[model samples]
Target: MKPWLLLGRAQPPGGGAELLLYQRDSEFSLKADNQELMNSRVYGSEEAMARLGCQNLGKRPGARVLIGGLGMGYSVRTALDTLGEDARVVVAELVPEVAEWNRGVLAELAGRPLDDRRTELHETDVAELIMAARGDYDAILLDVDNGAEAMVREGNNWLYSLPGLTAAHGALRRGGVLAVWSAVPQPAFVKRLRRAGFGVDEVKVRAHGRSSRKGGAHHVVWVAKRG
Candidate 1:
């Protein structure tokens, strides 16, 4: 059996906690204070985050997408694979070192997604990006902070708040999809989506691929559509 080796540590700009990156043979993981945040091997839900949103757009040329949380670049790669040639994917990563990890050690994990010409990397908060844009994106995929529950960063709760949900609604084009990945279900969030003028649908996906449930935990992704 191979042991997990610590690759590096990153200090989040928010200045609350430190993120530790570890590698175990071919797989990698990001954790904070010994709490597992994201794992490279269990990315089915992350891929679903992009798939469920981009599928709503249906190969639209020049579709613009915003992905929050560049964990291992799974969602970004999935979006690139799901969208058309002219589509642009803007990935907002709060932690700078995560991007460096993707470009360096973890590049091959998601097929070096950041290297794609259609993809842009923003070393900023996704909330700020959502607030700054108006009807700008065809889809907004958020796999940040274990979803609406908000574990990694205390400030990430804003992304799931009523105002944040409203910002996401305003940031999307008409009929655009806002996909969110969560470690657990929050019924209040479903209601907030409706209050924010989004038609919401929820899907439960295994952390590992559908072929097997590596663990019993099932992650949920909320596909909220703006009209």
Candidate 2:
């Protein structure tokens, strides 16, 4: 088979994989292996959106957020729901197409993540945003570039590295939260979160499938509070 330009992909029910095909910039869907595409959360699921309210200290005011890697917009949608009107959110997406694809085909799948008025989409690397926004955000979410281990791109390694983690540390306000998503548990990444001066809480969040009164599938969502 020819290497078609895939716009988006996800693992469907019963471990089946689905690919959003793109030809001449038009999006289509086809079945593929689970390993072929990137992983994202269910936009409308309660479990995936839980972090929004849990991390928000209070309904008082003055909460600002910066989200790195606007995967399917589930995180952003979740954040918007939890935050107050005073809150400001900046969503940095490295690949504009990912953001575009979300609208093109996966719009309903991922939800219209960029449609929210409170959300700002930046067509740039999250690292640059991390570096630029020192002590500017109350929450920072890294929901892009595969898991923390990184499979899609190499530069994402910096976000999980010592310096990268440190930059994230600087981007948050006091008691701010740095919520990171990973497909599997990363021990060293946990340690690095602590080393970066964050009171880390590693949340074992299952995928959207098994999410119920109990829990979902197997995944990691690191909630690190700025110290």
Candidate 3:
């Protein structure tokens, strides 16, 4: 068996913990506080998050999307592939080193999504972008932390709160979608999404890609639409 090599380490701005990057041959992993946050080998849910969030976008030439996390860049790449040529994808990654890793050692894992002309990188908190916008994005996808539980930072809980959900609601255009990826199901958060005036749907996806015949762990993707 191959050993995982430590590639790089980064500290999230304002987060108490450090994020570690590791590689084993072609596979990669991003972890925080010893907890695996994302892995190169398991990205089916991440891809599904973007696909479900942007399903309504189709080939819309002017569609604009915002991705909250840049883990391995799978969500952004999937979104770029789903949207039209003129579509714009704004990626907000709180950790600078995560973005740097995507450009360096981890670039090929997700096909160098940052190099894509349509992507606009923001080395800031996704909450700031969500709160500052008004009907700006056609879809907002969040893959931050460990879902509503806030594994990396306690402040991340705000992203799942009523106020944060309201901000996200206002950030989206009419009929826009907000998709959130979580390692586990969050039933209470689903109620909050409805309370924030979004029509919500909870989707369960396999951890491995759809092409995988072998079954594996399941993840949750909450698709909430702003009506």
Q: Give the best candidate by TM-score.
A: 3
lDDT of 3 by residue, 1-93 (tens): 899999999878886568999999888988997999999999999999999999969677699999988989999999998998899999999
lDDT string, candidate 1, 19-124, tens digits: 9999888878899768888998788888878899899455687899999989889889999999888889999999999999889998898899999999999999
lDDT of 2 at 143: 71
| Residues forming the 10-long window of minimal summed lDDT in candidate 3 | 145-154
- Residue 94 in model 1: shift from native, Å? 0.7
Tell me the TM-score of model 1. Answer: 0.95
Compared with the true structure, all predictions reach lDDT values of 0.89, 0.66, 0.92
Segments of candidate 2 deviating more than 4 angstroms: 1-54, 57-60, 209-216
Q: Model 3: how far is 170 from its true place, Å? A: 0.4
Alpha-carbon lDDT of model 2:
0.66
Using lDDT as the measure, name the better of candidate 1 and candidate 2.
Answer: 1
Q: What is the lDDT of residue 171 in candidate 3?
A: 98
Any runs in candidate 3 off by more than 4 Å, and if so which? none
Better structure of 1 and 2 per TM-score: 1
